[model samples]
Target: MSTAKPSQFGVAGLGVMGVNLALNIADHGFSVAGWEFSPKRLAAVQAEKPYERLKTTGSLEEFVGMLERPRRILLMVTAGDPVDQMMDRLAPLLSPGDVLIDGGNSWFQDTQRREKAYREKGLRFIGMGVSGGEEGARHGPSLMPGGPAEAYEHIRPVVEAIAAKTDQGACVTHVGPGGAGHFVKMVHNGIEYADMQLLAETYDVLRRGLGLSPDALVNTLAEWNEGISGSFLLETTLQVLRKKDPETGKPLVDLVLDKAGQKGTGKWTVQVSLDLGVPVPSIASALDARNLSAMKDERVAASAKLPAPQAALTDEEKQHLAAWTHDALYAARVVTYAQGMRLIQAASKEYQWNVSLAELARIWRGGCIIRAKLLTPLREAFTQQPDLPNLVVSEAFAPVLTRMAPAWRRVVGTATRLGIPVPVFSSSLAYLDSYRSAELPQNLTQAQRDAFGAHTYQRRDRPEAGFVHSDWS
Candidate 1:
């Protein structure tokens, strides 16, 4: 393969994400070499008005040779088999101290396995999660990098320079060793699912229940952007609501298809939470809602077979509902984030990742999709109490939850009464209620399990260290 002058950084797979990230690196003043597997993609990139510091080559051998010693190569390819395929091609070309970074929405288990394999070969593997879509990639994205601490120094300058920054610092950090970065990213996506689903449910409630027009909704969201409810998604939601369909002169959002698409990170998050025995009701409900949304035909058929909503709210009641909905959404968001943080805590313990929850909040504050006004308080909460088990119970948030409890209940009750399926809203309330309750109905569940499957359970009257069995005839 043909060789070129060495670059300080190399990015493989010149797709949208790859190309933008390469430009971002080059914009940060680092010389970047990029590789594209397909000749067409290579030609397309070459045709672009090139950045002086950015170089492209189609050959993997030539790409590897173009990187400086102890090379740092960032792969933005598709996850799963494609990542493995790239690793196979690069393994022989990389030297002992050379670093390989996977910047994709990959499963954390795969990252752990790959890191182990690469470490055995005296190479470093970083499973990095780069958030922020095409725009963020071109400008600045939040970066979560997990690998050996020793190897981080090699790529830290480029990473920090290209990452979004807040008053705290750049939105890039060594999350932990091995798969921690991907694991955190998985939870981030799950939270995003919950966030978007909650917003959609809120929209449905306001649009259908309150009969608010798209323009009205957009104004409301824009107003919310200046308040505690402000977030990137909320800001983006305003943009979506403001768009008009050129063909029909209707709101673009109304004209768009309802079938929500997913790339499996939400599913992976739920699966990992189940594996770890962490309750992520809001996230799970969000994922389930997407799947349910996908079955559009079945839902339409069922709508014909099933009864339509009959309960209606008065104008005054609708106003009250809107006010309560704001508090409800905020409370639900708190629970959703708490649940996601809990999952990270469980994974950190199981994997000994030493993940900083405060840092997570800080890094996520700027570049990521989930960035919000709420994360500032969240970061402060975690900083104040690093080992805080749950955000709802934390000092900074508990008072907010306490105040929002009544309004949250009112919104959920109103949605239920109106026959609006607020799955995320309802699930988030359920999660909060379940978390706050000192007593639950699990005793009977334990009894049933013991009776049917001989699964021993602890007694409520005694210490939980002993698993006692009961015979119910």
Candidate 2:
């Protein structure tokens, strides 16, 4: 008789994320079996002996065999082709009712298709969005899982056990069915891009306009973090600013290249938003900023020919710049999140996901990269009105925005006068302004389209008439 015991959970693709997750599962007293195609990775994990309850194998078959029946597996591989290849290989080995989770930043449509295909094969496919980086994985991460309800039930215990916990509860949820999890995660990344860009812009303005040193900047941000502006990214920024290069003994961030890198999620968010007819200009602008940053050489060359505005801040502007920027940062951040949430809402309605924005807010309160203090009231706003048309108009935020609009405008105006680029700030403010306005210049746009192309327009007086064309000859 064999004296072997089957693992409760299985993980394929033992990369950094996979190994840490496996270890996390083991730490929670679940026997975990990990499969790695790379012998080097397998050997390294085995040598580490991080957990006695965890086992690693290079053989996929052995890895599957060692897992308990109706096996629960997590595929932490690169998104796209790798996920499909692994699914194909695992299909023959998995029994009916087995569950497989794709724990990557995958395209939501891909997840939807994979779920359908797996269901046809009598297996359950879950598109799970695991947020927080390596450290979060080893400790805890916010988990967003969307799949068959029963399938979620199967792995819920393991996930909930390993997920980041807040005062409310675990940072995990059954987001919805199909690709809802990935969709939400995509928007989360989009919001992350905007928030990061907002921070970068703030840093640039404060550093250049105010002549604040790194230490001074840290102090300002630290004070902000103690209030509603507190966030994982802000804290990380402070840490980065505090870091000194060992070799040069200078602020490490200053020595680093100005170029930014991305992994396509931000672009996907913008693309999907357009498809769903949801405007996310803040996120769009952030994506554009990254694209523009990539052309550093071009920018350097253009700087010589293109002259910047030579305006300087007045005494009044000097005294209130930081205060105004603080308001702009908070207000713009709210708008950025509003855009992301609205995008999610549109997708939810389009796909019938029934995702609770409140639950998402709760889960995002900790662990995730975009975790912020604002999520609390944001959650409450959704709870109070599940069908909130826009977060800017939410009861909790409307007054705050009204109060802060003056300062936000001041920040934008000051930045503009100094020739500082604040794309997200300006775009987000425009989004807010457009949302608040009952009448817009789009009436002229309609007339122009109708005059040139005979594209019909709807009249305010007779909306029942529908599609009326005007002749301007």
Q: What C-alpha lDDT values do all the predictions have? A: 0.92, 0.95
| TM-score, per-candidate, Cα-based | 0.97, 0.99
**Model 2 C-alpha lDDT per residue in residues 1-473, reported as the tens digit of each score:** 55698999999988999999989999999999999999888898888956778888899999999999889999999999999999999999999999999999999999999999999999999999999999889999999999899999999999999999999999999999999999999999999999999999999999988999888999999999999899999999999999999999888989989999999999999999999999999999999999999999999999999989999999999999999999999999999999999999999999999999999999999789999999999999999999999999999999999999999999999999999999999999999999999999999999999999999899999999989987889
Top candidate (lDDT): 2
Instruction: Specify the poorest-scoring 10-residue window by lDDT in model 1.
Output: 314-323
How far out, in Å, is residue 443 in model 2? 0.8
Model 1, 351-427: lDDT tens digits are 99999999999999988999999999999999999889999998889999999989888888877888889999998
User: Which sections of candidate 2 miss by over 4 Å?
Assistant: none
User: Which stretches of candidate 1 lie above 4 Å from their native place?
Assistant: 1-5
In candidate 2, how many Å is residue 84 off? 0.3
